[model samples]
Target: MRRLLPVAFIVFGVISGVQCGFGLNVTVSSFTKSITSSIGNGINLVVKANASIKIAADDDNSGTIRALIAVSNNVTTPLNRLLGSILAAATAENVNSDELFVNIFSLVAETRPALDAASNAASDLQKTTKEYLYQTLSGNLTELSTILTNLTDGLDYLHLQVYQAANEEYPVTSKNITIFINSTVIADITMPLEAIQNYLTHVASVITVIASERTQVIKYLTQMNETISNGLRNIQNSASGFNRTVIDAYHRIMAQQVNTFKNINQTYAAIVSRASSYNGGDISNLTMFLSDLVAANASFLQFVSLSTNYTMEQINPVLQDRIAAATKTLTRVARFIANQSAINISQHANQCAQRFMQKLQQNPVVITRLSRCIQQDSNALQPTVTFVQYQMDLVRSAASSIANQMSKVCQRNTGACARAYFAALPDHSQVIQNKISVIAGVVSNDEHVVTGRIINCLYGTGADIIENALLMTKKFNRCMLVGP
Candidate 1:
C-alpha cells in the first residue's frame, strides 16, 4: 500500500504539471485573440471614417499614407469618390474662366445703351437752349458769331471722329470698353463744355443758320417731286405713241414680207419635186446617147446651130423673165420654207415624197411650154443670134454675182450656209445643162443634146459655178471674225 501511495503521488505531480502548462497556453492564446480582435476593430473603424470623409491631400506623404491605408483596409470606393470630386472642382475652375469672358462682353454692351440715351438727351438740351438764346438775343451779331464758331468747331471734331470710326481698319479698338469710356468722357464733359460756353454767347446766329437750311431742304424736295411727276407723264405718253408706231409697222411691212416668203417657198418646193423627176433617168446614159447623136448626123448639127440661135434670142428672154418671176417667188418661197414644218426624214417619208412630187409637177409645165415655143422657132432663130448672145452674157454675169453673194453669206469652212451653197451649185449646173440640152436637141435633130449646145452651156455654167462655189467657200473662213 505504502509503495502504491508513493507512485500515485508521483503520477499526480506529473498530471499537475501538464494541467498547469495547458492552462498557461490557453491563457496566452485568449489574451492574444482579444488584443487582435480589438486592433482589427480599431482598424475597420478608422477605415470606415476615412472612407466617409473622402480626404484629398496634395503632399506625397499624406496622399501615399491615405492610399496605403485605404488599399490595406479595402476602402477603394472612398478613394475613388475622393478622386472624382477633386477632378470636378478642377473642371469647374476652368469653366469659370470662360464664363468671365462672356460676362465682360455683356456688361460692356449694356453700358452703351445708357450712354446713347444720355447723348440724345444732351443733343435735345443743346437745341432747346439755342432756341431760347435766339429768342432772347434777337440780333446780337458779335455774340452770335462767337457762339457759331464754337459750335462749328465742336461739330467738326465729332464728325471727324465719326468718319475715322467708319473708315478705320477691322478689329475696331474705339468700340472697346476702355477706349470708348475714355473717349466719351472727353467728348461729353471736356469738349462739350467749351462748345456750350460758346453757344451761350452766340446762340441766336447758330439758330438762324439752322432754320434757314431746314427751309431750303424742304423747298428743294418739293421742286424735285414736281419735276419727277411731269417727266414721268411725258415719258408715259411718248412710250405709248412709239409702241403703237412700232407695232403697226411690224404688222404691215415685216409680216407681209414673211407671208410672201412663205408662198415663194411653196413654189420653190414644187419646182424642186418636178426637177427631181425630170433628172430621174440615168444622166450618164443620156449624156452618152446625146454625144453619139451629135457625132452621127449633119442635120443634128444644123438643128443645134439653129437651136443655139433661137435659145439666145427667144428662149433665154423667156427664161430670164421666168427667172425674174421665180426670184421673187423664191424669196417668199425661202421664207415659207423657213416656217414650214421641220423635215424629219425618218418619220415622214411619205409626206416628204408627196411634197417633192407635187413641186416637181408644177414647174415642168412652164418648162415644157417654153421648150415647145423654142422648138417652133427653128426657122427664125438665125435672126435672133445677137439677142441670144447678149442673154447668155447676162446669165453668166448673174451667175457670177450669185456665186459671190453665196460665198459671202456661207463662210468658207464647214458652215451650214457653205454646205447649202455647194450642194445647190451642182444642182444649178445640172439645170442649166438640161436647158442647153433641150436647145441643142431642138436645133440639131439629135435625140441627145450632149453634143454641142448642152455641153457648151454645161462647160460655161460649170466653170462659173465652180469658181463661185470656191469663192463662197472663202467666206466661211472669215466666220470667226463675227464676235459674240
Candidate 2:
C-alpha cells in the first residue's frame, strides 16, 4: 500500500508539470495570434486610409482639371473661328482683285488705243469743222450742211473705237481672253467700267452730228439776222413802209436768235470743263480701290499671324502646364499617402512583434526565433515599400513627361496648320499680289495715254465743234420755220 501511494504521487507530479507546460504554450500561441491580428488590422487601416486619401485627391483635382480644360477649349475656339473668317475674306478679296486685274488688262490692251483713236477723231472733226465754218461763213447753206454732215459722220463712227478694240483684243467668240471676261466678272466690274467707254463713245457721236450741221445752219441764221435788221431799220426810218405786225415779228425773232447763240457758246465752255473734272474723278476712284485691296491683304496676313501666336504661344502652354500640374499634384498626393501608410503599417507590425516577444519569455528559443522572423518580415516590407515608391515616382514622372509630350505634339500640329495655311494662301495670295502690281503699273501708263487722248479731245477742240454743229442745226430749223 505504501509503495502504491508513492507511485500515485509521482504520477500526479508528472501530470501537473505537463499541464503547466501546455498552459504556457497555449498563452504564448494566443499572444502571438493577437499580435499578428493587430499587425493585420494596422495594415488594413493603412490600406483604407490610402484608398480614402486617393478618393479625396481625385475629387479635389478632377473639377479643377476639367474646368481648366474647358477654359482652354473656349479660348482656342475663337482662334479657329477667326482663322476661318479671315481666310474666307481673303479669298473673296483675292477673287475681286483677280477680276479687276482682267478688266484692267483688257482696258490697257484694247480700250486704251481705241480711246486714243476716238479722241483724235474728235479733235480732227473739231478743227476741220471750225476751219470750214470760219472760211465759208457766207457760202451756200445746203452745200455746207452736206460737207459738215460727211465730216461729222466720220467722227461719230469713231465712237465704236473702244468696242472694236475690245473685240479685237479679246474676241467675244474666240477662246483665250474671252474666258476671263465671263458673266460673273463682267457683271461685277466690267459692265460699270465699260459703261464709261460707251458714254465717251456716245459723246463722240453727238459731237460729230452737231459739228456737221453747225456752220451750215449758222449761214442761214446770219441771213435771217441781216434780213431782220434791214426790216427793223426800214420800219424805224419810215413807219409808213411796213405794218406794225411785221415790225414786231422781226424784232422778236432777232432777239430770240441772239440769245440762243450766246447760250450755246456758254454751254460749250461749261461742258468742256465738267467733262474733264468727271474723268479725273473716275480715275481717282479706281486708283483708290486698288490701294484698298493692298491694305486688305496686309491686314489678312497680320490676322493670321495673330491667330497662330495665340494658339501656339498662349493656349498650348496654358493647357499643357495646367494638366501637367494637376497630374503631378495627384501623383504626389498618392505617393505621400502610400508612404505614410507603409510607415504606419510597419510601425504597427514592429510594435506588435515587440509585444509578442515580451510576453513569450518562457519559450525563449521560440520567442527569439519568432522575433527574428517578424523583424525579417518588417525588413522585407521595406524593399516592397521602396519598390512601390519607385513605381509611384515613375508614374509621376510619366504624367509630367506625357504632358510635355502632348505639348510638343500640340506645337507641332500648330506649326503644321500654319504651314498648310501658308501653302493654301500662296495660290491666291501670290497671284493676287502679282496681278495687283501689274495692274498698277499698267494703270499708270494707261492713265497718261487716256488723259492725253480722250479727256483732252472732249474738252479742247471737240467742244467747239459740237457747239458750232448744234447751233447750225437750230438755225437751219429756225430759218425754215421763219422764211427768209
Candidate 3:
C-alpha cells in the first residue's frame, strides 16, 4: 500500500509538469509571432519613412508624401508598445532582444518630421541666401563699372595732356594753354572718379542696400561734376602760367635768333668785302683772276723749261719738284673754294659746326681739310709757298664762316633740346602715374564683376531670383513626395 502511494504521487507530478510546459510553449509561440510581426511592421514603417523623406528631399514626388504619412500612422505608440511587450516577454533571458525593440521604436519615433523639416529648411535657406547675394552683387557690379569708366576716361585725358606736353615739334608754349586745360580737366575728373572708385571698392564689401549703393553712385556722379569744376579752375590757372612762360620764352628765342641772323649777315658781308679786295673788285672778278693766275703759272712754267740753259739732270729734279708743288697748291685752292661755296650755301650748317667746336676747341671738318692739304703737299718745293699761303688764308676765312654758322645752329638746337627735355619731363611722369591709377581701378572693377558673376551663377540672375526661388520650392515639394 505505501509503495503504490509513492509511485502514484510521482506519476501525478510528471503529468502536471508536462501539461504546464506544453501550455507555456503555446504562449511563447503566440508571443513570438506577435513580436516578429510588430518588428517587421516597425522596420517597414521606418524604411518607408526614411525613403519618403529622402525622396522628398531629393526630388519632389507624390508617392514619397503618401509614404511619409503612412509611416507616421504605422509607427503609432499602440503598435510600438505592443511589439515592446512581446519582445520583452519572448526574450526574458536576452538583454539584447529588449534593447533592439527599444532602439527600433525610438528611432522611428524620433526620425519623423524633425529630420524632414531640417532638410527642407536648409534647402530653402540656401536658395534664399543665394538670391539675396546675387541681387547685392549685381547692383555693386553695376556701380563699380560706372566708377571704373569714369576713371578710365579721366586717365585718358591725362594721358593726352602728358603726350602733348612731352612732344617736341608741337610748340609747348602755343599748346601750353590747351595742355594745361586738359591736365586740369583730367585731374579734376580723376579726383572724383578716384574717390568714387575708392569708395566703391571699400564699401562694396560691407554694403547691403541697393538703394544705398545707388546713392553712392549718385555721389560719384556729383563728384564727377565737382571734379569738372575743379579741373576748369586748374586749367585756368595752368593756362595763365603756361601762356606767360611760353610768351616770354618765345620772345627771348626770337630775339636771339634775329640777333644771330644779323650777326651772320654782317659776317658774310665782311667776307664778301675781303674777298672782293683780294680778287680785284667782286666775286666774279675774283674768280676770273684765279683763272688768269692759273694761266700765268702754266705759261711761266713753260718759259722756264724752254728758256733756261740748265742741264736736263739739274732741271729735271727741281722742275719736277716745282711742278708737283704747284699742282698741290692749286688743288688745295680748288678744294678751299669748293668748301667755301658749300659753307655759303648752308649758313645753318656752318653755324652748327662752329658753335660745337667753340667749346671743344676741335673742328672735325676743318681738321680733315687741313690734313688733306698737308698730305697733298708732302713732296712740294718752296716756289709753291705763295700759292699755299693764299689758299690757307682763304680756307681759314671759309672755316671761320662755317664755325660761326655752326655756333648759331648749335645754340638753336640746344635751346630746342632743353625745351624738349623740360616738356617731356612732366609728361612722362604724369603718364606713368595715370597708367598705374587706371590699372588699379580696372583691376578693382574686374574683381567686382567676378564676384557678381559668381553670385549670379551660384544662385540666379538678379532678374530671375524670385522666379528661381519659386521653382526651387516647387521642386523641393515634388522631391519630398517621392520615395527612394
lDDT of 2 by residue, 1-484 (tens): 0000111110000111111010111111122222122122111211122222211112222132122222222212222232222222212321333343333334333433433333333333322233332223212212322332332332223223323424465333323322432234223322332232233233323333332233223333333335334433432333222123222322342343234323433433332344344233223322333344345435433443343233223322332343333333323322232222212223342233223222222222111121121122222222322333343334233322322343344444225432342233334334444543342333233323422332332233223333333343344333334422
Q: Cα miss at 115, model 3 (Å)?
A: 28
TM-scores of the models, in the given order?
0.18, 0.15, 0.16
Candidate 2: stretches off by over 4 Å: 1-282, 346-484
Q: What ranking emerges by TM-score with the best candidate at the front?
A: 1, 3, 2
Best by TM-score: 1
Deviation from native of the Cα of residue 121 in model 3, angstroms: 27
Per-residue lDDT tens digits for candidate 1, residues 221-300, read 33333433443344334334333432343233223323433443343343244433323322333333333333323332
Candidate 3 lDDT by residue in tens digits, 252-275: 423432343344345445535555
- Runs in model 3 deviating more than 4 A are 1-423, 458-484
Which one wins on lDDT?
3
